[model samples]
Target: MSLPETMQLSLGPVLFYWTRERYADFYREAADWPVEIVYLGESVCSRRRDMKLDDWLGLGRELTQSGKQVVLSSQTLIESEADLRDLRRLCDNGEFRIEANDQSALQRLSAARLPFVAGAALNLYNPATIAVMARAGMQRWHAPVEMSRNDLARLLADCRSEGLDQPCEVFAHGHLPLAWSSRCFTARHHRKPKDRCQFVCRQHPEGLALRSQESKEVFTLNGIQTLSGACQDLRHEVSDMAGMGVGVARLSPRAEGMAGVVAAFDAARRGELSAPDPLALVEAEICDGYWHARPGMDNSRATTAP
Candidate 1:
């Protein structure tokens, strides 16, 4: 089967610790956004309980009412009984689709015989892995960050040959979620233990900044997640992704100026995008090397400086 010319847009789960009011306002406003799918839930540290399951379900209902496919995402690192309980509840809801972010959640979800969306955190690198998960009932799979255009093309081909049905979604914008560890960087930075973080990450909604060994602005530190400092702008590759069988472009939420971010990506996908200083207003610098199969940090735009 051939892919469509226009790729769909999807807003990924909000990964920061925003206040209840801020969180409500953000999704409430997003209820009208033209994205095809919206994944909502606490995918980061669970201690940051700014919103509860009921609140998330309420927003999911609202978004679903607005005709958007809503997926409640499971936690990335489920280490607590409470987290596991929440995961069970989310998957058991039977009302909204769920995104499995970790192995534990995936195992439980599989055991329950419930189908779930494959969150990007899943290691779906090749055709064999993709086929394995597809057979296990992954209706849709999120493309990993470091996976490339060619790799995805082969996976798509294999999906077709193996009859592993699923829609492909790519991480288009937002800081690249590099890694998640059991240790909290925020607490480590302050010389505090993980058990007593004092919620330091809540202060920097986007995340704390980290410089490179060369003293260059490089990475951002979230509780236990290290992310690329650059806001990945793959709008330019919207058409390319679609050609390679990508159905949706997944955009991660940022603290400030999400409306503009959505609009810019929407416009770019339609090939009607034109803006002055588009790069300057970005909350972080831009990166697209992984999409182009180049080094993650080096900018293709910078190399061809003509």
Candidate 2:
């Protein structure tokens, strides 16, 4: 019942705006989890100042001491010079590896000759771009969320032919980060502007859920990040991913029941259990169409079946 020897579990950065204590506590608990890699830092919005860079670094140090490979993640969108400065500090920290969520971070890390992880937000679609990233010192790559299994297989086959050996990771669990916007949707929901919005995002803990006029869950808004209403569950596809030469499976951190989630994936990878039904862990609908090259929201159970 052994899984692929190369398959490792990774904990992605916390996408939610959590209290500093809760955030620290989460990592403290994660320090002993079965996961091998831990990605830290605030990657969504620059306004989430509840946890600063030093706090993340301090936590990263603790995780590293606990024997986990920690990687500092950069913001997905860089809107201000201050954000740029913060990104620079993360890159120059010269301790843990960096997960470049934005191209600016990629350029900074490449220029410094530091090996980095090209995050899913980078939109690395083809082997050509992947090769370019490899040349730029991307030691690992997280395939974009929308990429299908067949597409990734073809790309990886091409990369193999070209002798590109950079390892790749996939977002295997949690809510899919669909898109980013400059406008603060959270503030707008609270009748506030982007500049003076009094940090209303914290009130939702897991981001505010948005529903259609018919009361169908559509999207979730967290500051400027728009996420899928249904959390993505690719545990069923772990074997497929392993067959494609994926080296790591990223489990994005959630607010509650993360321990059980991690255990489920761990056991699944160890071939002790099947992937738990994603709907059991989430209140919203579940989707896996993107993995099948269909509509992003269409899982076999959805009403919009083909």
Candidate 3:
């Protein structure tokens, strides 16, 4: 499909733990929000048992009733037969689109002829891969947390030239999901392995905060994934994003206070909002340098995100 100029808002899948009731209630309330798309599923360690496939599908159906486009997310870094099976099932489900997080999921999705969402976990950098995927039935392509505006502009231009029609979504907010591993770090840190993780990642909600040698709080450990300590804040970059032709800005879920964030982005997109520090208190530290190919931890005052 051709990309539109209208600003789109989406809530990326929750990467933390909340009770099943809380999870359901969150989506229930999201029906009243201005979000256009909602991605649901357990993308992290399968050990996260707050909800199951049937429960997720039920919520997806309810969210669809609310007039929101729902996509089921596949696990990144699939290791076992079970993971592959689940990915195939999600990709095969004609009821909703699949968000393929890894190449394995991408392969299955491609073979299934499903127009899917290319999850950020896939390092889809250039136009050729994007075109290939679009031809293979990719409907939307999500920019990895660290992609920059200039690079994105080139990619979009390339898409237009290649006649590849796909919406480009960016990680406009939330903690930068930096890396994922085959072994569970949060569980390992607590003296455990993948098979015996005992699902410790869930207990931490927002993942376990990891500090530096200087005792600086630098990163967070969730299951086998490592993330930036500071949540990515694109509140100030809404104009830049729109100007650069971003179709949608994905706001990752937080522990609380997300509606205000949604409202801020919407108002900004529509020229109804103003702020000096839009995401003032949300980020542990601001870092847009990664998006600029600079130091991943460096914060820029000229165009910092926070």
Q: Which numbered prediction scores highest in lDDT against the true structure? A: 2
Among these predictions, the greatest TM-score belongs to 2
Per-residue lDDT tens digits of candidate 1, residues 65-157?
A: 889989999889888888788878878887887899999878878887788889888878777888778777788889889888888888888
> What is the per-residue lDDT of model 2 for residues 82-176, given as tens digits with 9 covering 90 to 100?
99999999999978999999889999999999999999999998889999999999999999899998998998889899999998899888888
> What is each predicted model's overall lDDT from 0 to 1?
0.82, 0.88, 0.80
> Tens digit of lDDT per residue, candidate 3, span 113-198?
77789988887898888878888888988987788877888888788788876888999877789898887888778897778877
Give each model a TM-score.
Answer: 0.93, 0.95, 0.92
What's model 1's overall lDDT? 0.82
After superposition of all CA atoms, the RMSD between model 2 and the true structure is: 2.0
Better of 1 and 2 by TM-score: 2
Please rank every candidate by TM-score, starting with the best. Answer: 2, 1, 3
* Residue 215 lDDT, candidate 2, scale 0-100: 83
Model 2: residues with Cα > 4 Å off, grouped in runs = 275-279, 301-306
TM-score of 1: 0.93
Model 1, residue 37: what's the lDDT? 88
Q: Model 3 segments beyond 4 Å from truth?
A: 1-5, 278-283, 302-306
